[model samples]
Target: TEGLVMAKNSSAADQLELIALAVRGNVSLALAARAVRSAVEAGEYEAIARALADQAGRNDPLQPRDRALAATVAAELSRLGSKAAPLWQVAREAWELERSAWWLAYALFREAEALLSAAGKRDAARDVLVRARSIARLLEAAPLLAEIDALAGRGRVDLGSPSPQLLDPVPDRKLPISDREMEVLVLIAKGLTNKEIASELFISERTAAHHVGHIFDKLGVSNRVEAASVAHQAGVLVEDT
Candidate 1:
């Protein structure tokens, strides 16, 4: 009976409301999945790719290349599997992708590395590591590089050992404080009570106490004296030797 209803009552707005309800409830993800499959069947490659990538990010249903382009990619990946050698060119291609999108590179590297390592090809695995490190250097991503190094070595080598390549430059901070917060912290470092700090900053004593508490938290210290020492170390305050 409802199938005979006119298009006016079942407007786009009504369709949208139904979509919202389905999404809010996750009532039928299989139906949603079928919709995506239908879209892919309809030659909506761009939309399918975006949606597949999003699902990949969310760890949802794994992509089995339901689209032509993705199927070609899967075939290419299969052909490029580490059956022969390290293939530096392939490694470099993976590195370039890694530089552009770390997660994407991560996916490719994980697959390639698994194949190489499983075959007991340590040299090829090390080559993959070198390319990954090069990409990491380009991106200035220390933590990610460290993680890759750790996984590449498979605990055979200690990652914490200091090496020239591991040294990422530290950034300089001027006083390590914002001007507004520094104004209040300096008064505290001068041995002023909270009430006195309030009088100096023209704020309430309660507000002054709150600021001092925040200062302690930021400095990672429990008391005023340690906070002062941190401030001096941070160059927020100069102390004569």
Candidate 2:
């Protein structure tokens, strides 16, 4: 889990650099996947989402290999046990932007599983899986279809026909805090001092203080406790289990 450790400590820009290097053949896809997995596990969710969105929004289309890699990263995020909603949102956005029906279906499938397993919304989850199954059929993706069948069999849930709106992308909402600021906020919530946050995030104490100041301003709070309160209320921080 060296990659995971590195990703937890590195800045978002450094993580993106690793991805770029992978794309340019300076690093292996395995390393790229590790970086992506690490980012997801480290809760650098917004950073990953924004990077994928930016790539998707580019006028120049992504190469097939890059698209596949992006899809892989999205899929990995979708499978996370916690924070699945945000991750699935990012994955859905990427697949929709790419117009990859199969990948979109897969993303839906994972979201449904997360809903069922993590959130305990069985009926809603089944509905989403139904949407995924329909898309898989339309694309003639036998593997995806088979996986859907397996999921249905295992869950013993009767899936209905797809709802027309089930696969539609949710509108993107902007967060008040930047990704770097969010990282600082999370560490602050953990009761880390500025020096500690700096060490954890691999930045200077002065830079960490600067980020803390920005976070306080953006959140309209004067201290770490108030900042954590605002972040929790805003749903920026995951609920404690």
Candidate closest to the true structure, highest lDDT = 2
Which candidate wins on TM-score? 2
Prediction-by-prediction clash tally: 0, 0
**Candidate 1 similarity to native, TM-score:** 0.28
Model 2: per-residue lDDT, tens digit, 69-116?
Answer: 464465454443355655565566667767788888988887776665
Instruction: Kindly report which residue stretches of model 2 are placed more than 4 angstroms away from their true locations once superposed.
Output: 1-81, 161-241
RMSD of each: 19.5, 19.5
Model 1 ranges with Cα > 4 A deviation: 1-101, 155-241
All models: lDDT? 0.50, 0.64
Weakest lDDT window of 10 consecutive positions for candidate 1? 60-69
lDDT of 2: 0.64
Question: What TM-score fits each model?
Answer: 0.28, 0.41
